[model samples]
Target: MGTKFGSVIHRADRGTFRAKYTYHGEVITKTFKDRLSAEAWLNGERSRVEADKAGITKWTSPTDRKRQEAAVKRRRTLFCDYVMDEFAPTWLNYATDGSELASGSKRKHREYLQHLTHSFFWKYPLTSITTEDINRWLADLDNFGGATPRKKTFQLLKAVYSKAVAEGAVAKSPVTMKAPAVPKSRQAQIPPATAEELQTIYANMPSTTRISVWLGAILDLRIGEVVSLQVQDWNPKTQTLRVCHSADVNGQLKSTKTATSNTTQPVPPQLGKLIDKACEDKRPTDFIVTCADGTHITPNRLRDHFNEAKTKARRPDLHFHTLRATSITAAVATGASLKDTMQWGRHADAATSIERYQRASGTERMREIANGIEDTLMGHEPTREELEAEIQKTKERLADLERQLDALK
Candidate 1:
């Protein structure tokens, strides 16, 4: 039986006091160690019991001594209760926006958290989680595959721990305790097409799909942007295609992948004409590119059909992202510098696109310059007979100019 009186003596833990009473139906006896706190609580209980005042606030536990023992046992045997239960929601959302993860990155985070709970992190109090534990997780993650997943797993760990730090659930994240050394996976950017190859590709597809993907790769629009292109999004007067909206799985309005994604992409004259054709005789709400069923084309379906075009063109390596890669290549070839490529790609990150995607070594650059010079000089070189023909043509042009000048006089 629990003690009816609420008197409590302060324990060695200082703040905790031991008291026994019926609190809310449970006979919870734990430490309620503070003197003033114990007295206030006891008076409240006495008022409720003696005066029959049902409105008095109830104490946390019916038996305070037993609760204190249970708490001590938990602390001695358990390592898991570091982060408070209430702090999880904010931390999950933190992984999405604050971390700058890839699309659907939350799914990966859930996996990491689920794994950590089953691993040693489950028992280690969030405050007590050490650098060794994080490194151990990294070691186990590295055994799975190459650099990409290892980096992904490391990032997930950082996010979850960082959240605990922010919520005051831990003194500091073990993530910050040690630097993790991870090898970078250099994603081999697909090479862009020469003008001739593009002409070949553009020739194969119907005007609508060909130009749409081509413009997308050039603009570096997110896959969602490709599907949401509308007739009104094109402004021929400005020779620009606006990216005003993006689609979800259900083809509804959603915020673009990032703020940078909502941008205007300059449409070349050739692509502008294709947009016009797709929009020809269509309503304002009509789409630019559609499926066989006349619904807007999704990114997955676009990539599938784009592959067929690549196959027919005898270039099997090309993919949808390749189009954007090729566009940056073309911009570079046209003397659009690396900084220009970043702008076109809408990379909010300040690094030049050449660093991220394009790699033009000094040797390759000199070769390109040599080839350009050779092509220019070779195209206009004059042979002996051709020189004589040019002399005659020049005399005729001079004579024509003289005639025009005299006629004007």
Candidate 2:
């Protein structure tokens, strides 16, 4: 009486022995801990086996043997080798970088696939994996990186296995064996600094380095473009900086991120003056901006300077991207159109600019509403005194509500 759905073991060596058997053209092995266990186990399964395989017979197991058989039948397969051999091929290529994916994308895929290989996906045969296997995998994904990541990784795996099917490896992708859903919620980015904070950073910067910093943040010129400025790229007449090329500290010419990335950026008036002054002492043969050592600025040195600026401004969250973001925000706030903002941000999409830099504070929104009401009611906007008084009253109301909530807790 072997375990349910396993071979019936008649007898074996005194120690545990496994019996190999064929069922429906597939081989399976049934293990027995001892001869007595095998005999007692098989004896009970005889009638059931005969009923299943034979014309007629009735079988019943010894109570403990029946329990043991049930336990063995219920044991699950769990292994890593199965995934590498059966699932990893057609995709999961480490040769290609996944950096182009948005933030946390790589981390999500790595964690989910890692757990699948180590936990269960590799343990079972490709045919044995079921809807249940995929459901559990997605749940773990949700716990790790939220529902969006789980959904994304699920789609990624599905694509990987679809490729596998095309490669004549797996007959079909098992990704749709389970499907999970995430709620619809928009997650917009919260940029790290305001224009005031950015200007504060620029104010304390070294004069020699300040224009270079401003060129990147205010003009959104990439490091290469900022350092590569030739004296002739500046057009005082059009107030534009033609972005045909940019350079490294060594003035090495390299490709911009893309073909569209090779466009011009118009210099705002203030930024234009800084650039004008910076280009004043230029060698006709030299770049518009140079480092303190008088060589073209390197990306690393530009970042180092940006970091110094952040330190001076006491804003640790500032990055080169933040400077570029500040430039976009300033332009947008001053009523630049989306197309112009895109040109200034050098963003692949206008939505990216909106996502990364736009800040609509709740307090400012309420203030605007109050001021508008005052203007309509009195045919004039509120005085500073009226606005201040309103703000103080709102603060007290908020404090009282917070105190009440805290007391309840």
Candidate 3:
């Protein structure tokens, strides 16, 4: 006779016991010589099933378990293969912050990945790469170029290891060191162009592209935004310009840099007229700035023209982006509040308007402040001309007060 205990079955004719179980629609069966062995195997299998159900393990069947183990081993054994073949492609699709990577950012990240190929541990397993290995690789970046490139490379590597950790490919990131800092000398702020210098640069630009200079200097638009403008973005009736998109280096139109950058700004009447003139015979879809052949003007093309214009104006140090700083500084000089300046520049915060765009006080404004300080602190007597001017100002105030009193009566 045959006896059965749970999923363990005894066959009398074969004098053997079989442990059999089904999990996730897959059958698992094994033969044992004795009943005790069959019972033991059955208990262990059931425990594995429970663990899998509880999310403690992924044990489904022996074949699936082997496949998962092999995949983990391959991820550990072939690090560069995992990175270049698997991780980089996936990581490039989405940024580390979980947003879709922009085209320009994707291109830059691809370049950064190339630097990792030159590392000594490029072929090492993910688990085998230690913090010391990452340090050595960073130290070797100097041979490739300057600190800026090295810093970017280090950041990319750190992001890679972080992805590996999240995927369970590595227990922890090996890139434990802080990022390398580029020297301050290389990060000095370029001074904004003066109003006179801006005029000279604009005058030197080609007639077809001169509007770009005004767009940048007056609207505080980025080069990308200037090149991305379309005929429809301008409202002649409302005298407003909409900034909703920017062009990448490849001249592909994309969303603006930030949510706040997509806004409707009041355009100066003069600039609005220029835009109306530019759109005279063009359709709404036509680009506002175009080359001679009527093709859309790319940022690179605008930049090349701007470079020539600046060179001719004797301001080779002036970049097209300096126009934005000039516009923000001009707004501040008009006694505009910080909030107004930030809105004019389309910046996210007032601190950026103050620290980055606004320049130091002009020579005349500083002189006025210095004179006022002397008068207040030194107790200097007013000159006869100043006293006479004060008396005339008082008479004007008395006249205004009397007029207001008569109106109230």
Candidate 4:
């Protein structure tokens, strides 16, 4: 009773069965201990050959299948390789909005990528990384210190995976963690420099660089914008200072931080005169503020001088940006509307001007408010001088209203 199975022969002399299959002009043979085992082996080989013919499988031979798998493994992208080789190179070229990132922003992304390389799963294949791996990496970021850095690193990592997903490298990202909260230290507002503090700092600054303080505290220009001011960017006739460019961390000239940051600010008479003096005997392309060698001053150098001046003024807490805060706060104190203050500060929105720059009312403003309340309660009569001032203000208001009505007509 010889077993009858395709390509399976009962070798009675050897007490075994031989199973053979031909695939792509190659033969595969295996010996089984019994007829049942041989039949099963032959059936599997036949099914595999059918699958190959139907284009369901790429290889029929086991060695060829192993080779195909090895080739696929070579094509897998690792996390570190994708970041360093592909993403980092083009990150600064365009932002999410398709605009070139500011140099400072580009620099920060480079730093974030550097930090990501330190993660434990940097060597893992992009598709193989799991949510548990991301969470673990975030836990390790705690040792790197500060919530801000951790948050930024996590965001960069998410962006990397997002790029991978967009390119069809993976079905989805594994970065499932919510964005880290802002640190409490950053949430607390630092007070703007008071009038007395501003004056003291101004007096302490060297005469040559005193205009930098005015630029910050009066025009509300950022440190980068201050250093990037050229003679052509100022208009003496209109008393307007245009902010079109700013210095990056490396002191390289780049566009302003945001589109709204490129604004023309109306300069006060005092600051305008100071600027005129700074621009004396200089070309239209010369920097408004320069070092002793007549070259544009770097932000670091300006900060060094500013730190010395603030220290001497007994306001070590006053950062360079505190001067900008002082300017916006002063504008608001002068009864400037929210929209006006937003334009004056060159902020993108009213909320940023109010929440980030404006500070609580100072002692003088508080006293003025209290005095007005007291006068109203006591029914204080207006003196002759006060009455004259009120009449003048009323006349001006009526004239302005008439002009607006005429324009409407």
TM-score of each: 0.62, 0.50, 0.65, 0.63
- Could you give me the TM-score of model 3 versus the true structure? 0.65
In Å, residue 13's CA in model 3 sits off its true spot by 29
Model 3 lDDT per residue over 162-219, tens place: 7778877777787888898776442235666786677888888877688899899889
What C-alpha lDDT, on a 0 to 100 scale, does residue 113 get in candidate 4? 71
Q: Which ten residues in a row have the lowest lDDT in candidate 1?
A: 78-87
What is the C-alpha local distance difference test score of each model? 0.63, 0.62, 0.79, 0.79
lDDT of each residue in 37-145, candidate 2, tens digit only: 6555444454555685665643333444666674444333222443455555423533234324322233455666764444356556544566667777666753446
Write candidate 4's Cα lDDT for 156-239 as tens digits: 888888987787667788888898776546323566788777778888876667689989988888899999999998899999
After TM-score superposition, the amount by which residue 138's alpha carbon in candidate 1 deviates from its true location, in angstroms, is: 0.9
Could you give me the TM-score of model 1 versus the true structure? 0.62
Model 1, span 51-104: residue lDDT tens: 433545443433454576655554453334443354345454453446443344
* Superior candidate under lDDT, 2 versus 3: 3
Candidate 1: give its CA RMSD in angstroms.
Answer: 12.0
